[model samples]
Target chain A: MCPAMGDVDIDSRTWRLLEPAGLTWRCWDDEYIVFHPWSGMTHYLDAIAGTVFELLLDHDATVRGLAAALANQADTPATDSLNVAVRQVLRRFDEIGLAEPIP
Target chain B: MQLGAVPESALRARFRATGVRLRLAGLCINLRTDVPAVIEQILQLYGGYPLEPGAGTDDARVHLKYASPLRRFIGRRTLVFVDGEPLYRPMLLRHAYLMIDSALDWCVSANVTNLVLHAAVAERGGLAVILPAPSGSGKSTICAALVTRGWRLLSDELAVFRAADGRLQSFALPITLKNESIALIRQWAPDAYISPVFTGTIRGDMAFLRPPTDSVTRAAETAEPALIVSPTYQVGAPLALQPLGKSEAFRLLTASGMNYYTTQRFGFDTVAGLVDSCPAWRLSYGTLEQAVDAIEDLLARVRMDPTASRPAITTT
Candidate 1:
């Protein structure tokens, strides 16, 4: 599972400031963005990698839970396609920092 | 004037901004420019690839070149070029769109794969808020206000969401300022670095800002969905955490979005989940300082106790 980065929340195009340091985080153009000031480098979260990070953030929930939650909310029924899609997405997020294990 | 792809080398004298790459239809621009004040930003947003032209074989790939129509996006496909060039005539929409749209490939790339939003984002610790609104709204003003008052600037536009797992995608691009916003930001951040005004653009003398050095350098990062605030500039208005429901946020974000149809299912779910999970509010203010204080106050409530209040229930 990808780490959610604490109880933090994510907004589209908007950035969430992470704690303990000045690093800022957000997902832009499908890439995970982690910007640090001191060194002046922005680590862009890759697609698959970012999905993995996202999985970690929603870790408390199970795979089934995720699929169910999303399907219901988006008005789509949970199906094999969704499950496959979820796995595929999670695999990518795992590769990026978008999803990681709870630390 | 046409909406088809053109080679990059064809138009090299349009852009006044510098970014890593602008891609469309598999055509990529391996171009670069100098922004003594903003190049560090170029590097930060693009992970610090040297702007110096390389002599590698990769330079031969043809990229599209775009000029004209600065006020509104010309179309989807075209390479936009901008450099330090002088023009005798006054500028207008074409000039503005060239620079603004030039930086948009990043937006297109992120949106095609992830859900892209038209919003302003600033961070202050673990919490981040996505500020989405129409063009005339005070998003830029609020962006300048929030950044100067301690909110770490994430972006002034385009909130990207990972379609797969739903983390906030970060693009450390510089902030965009228009009209009154230029002076407002310069006044607040006197020591802050800003690009010289580019006159005759769509918005009239627009300005660009470099992301905080911190946001550009840290590449490997992610954030969960948090708050959604829609800022409306009403000078003299007060603060309100109007809890907008998920459905409302969904509609608002989708309507104000750049490419909701590009990513389909994942984009819909990602946007819906984001609106449902986080808090929402609409802030109206006459003064920049008032807006800043109101944000601090609202943020204090959210960080200290999210349950204390909810986004003002949005109706329609």
Candidate 2:
């Protein structure tokens, strides 16, 4: 079985949806995606801060749980490379007005 | 009590008749008849004022004045009347409509060989600069200042290009200055035919400054595109130019162009050619005077060396 082909539910309150232009994305809120139709550009938010995002979308986990989730993501020596990558992506999202925090 | 196709000649004849006042945002307008109701409709959107009825002329023409929305058509022709005279609104609207409609048609009818840009353009010593920015970006204010500082005002707030020859067409509209910028230019250019103040717009009480008279009659002529700069009204800051890469410039230019996507084959090429042809930059600054000086220096540099590209300057 192809592991990538299977449905990977990281958590609740976080599900993946295909955007208007058919870009696959996982988000906690609508503001994470910026749709500039004229320029034909779509930007994703909270992508860099994957550790924090993954926890929230993972079964609607809370902030404290997110820190732990990030820590766990960091602990995996084999797959932990995604931790730094996730943080960078999240920073880029913030810089471009693609990310927002839930109040 | 009149209707039907109001052509220019008929309008000329009507201007020989009863004159009325049309007003918008405190500007008085004078127009001949045969102007459409659409122009009047636009003026009404601002604040329609009226002249003292029958003050137009001896032809029994209705002399009117009113406040006008500082507007430009991506077309040919420039019309300016006294600020806040309601008696001339209809005629003024008609004049604006005729000019705008014709210019728009000229751009489209000529085999898609022209691009009508919603920007302010001017040149000095044959070197030109086109300012393309979204509304409220202080483009008009800077252009007005440059023209007064001796730059030829090719256009006050639009950049029409005859793509057939890759030459820039000129416009006769006034330099539409808003808020503090309007007063600033008035103080800067003594020869500037400043109009009365207009207040209460979504963008603040905007006033327009008349561009050089030569620009009006020379609408058919075109200039080669040189520096493409975007201006921002960030007060109390020094003027600076920032680099604009082709890709980023294309994104912003296409975003700002009025009809880039409307003309199909030509639209794409026009935008592509422009981004490829001219060097673009982000000119961010607060005060109008500082921006004016920076643009003047850039213009001087462009004219002195036709091939010289102004170094990119960006202000934080």
- Tell me the docking grade of candidate 2: incorrect
Question: Chain B alone, TM-score of each model?
Answer: 0.69, 0.64
Off by over 4 Å in 2: A1-103, B1-113, B304-316
lDDT of every predicted structure (CA atoms):
0.55, 0.53
Which ten contiguous residues of candidate 1 chain B have the minimum total lDDT? B1-10
* lDDT tens digits by residue: candidate 2, A1-103: 1122111212111322222242223232322433333334444444335444444344544333444566565574323355345434433433443332322
Task: Please give me the total number of clashing residue pairs in predicted model 1.
Answer: 84
Report the poorest 10 consecutive residues by lDDT, candidate 2 chain A.
A1-10
Tell me the tens digit of each residue's lDDT in model 1 across B157-212.
Answer: 76767666776656545567888888878988887667667677656777666555
Error of 1 at B296 (Å): 2.7
What is the alpha-carbon lDDT of model 1 when measured against the actual structure?
Answer: 0.55
Error of 2 at A103 (Å): 52
Docking class of 1: incorrect
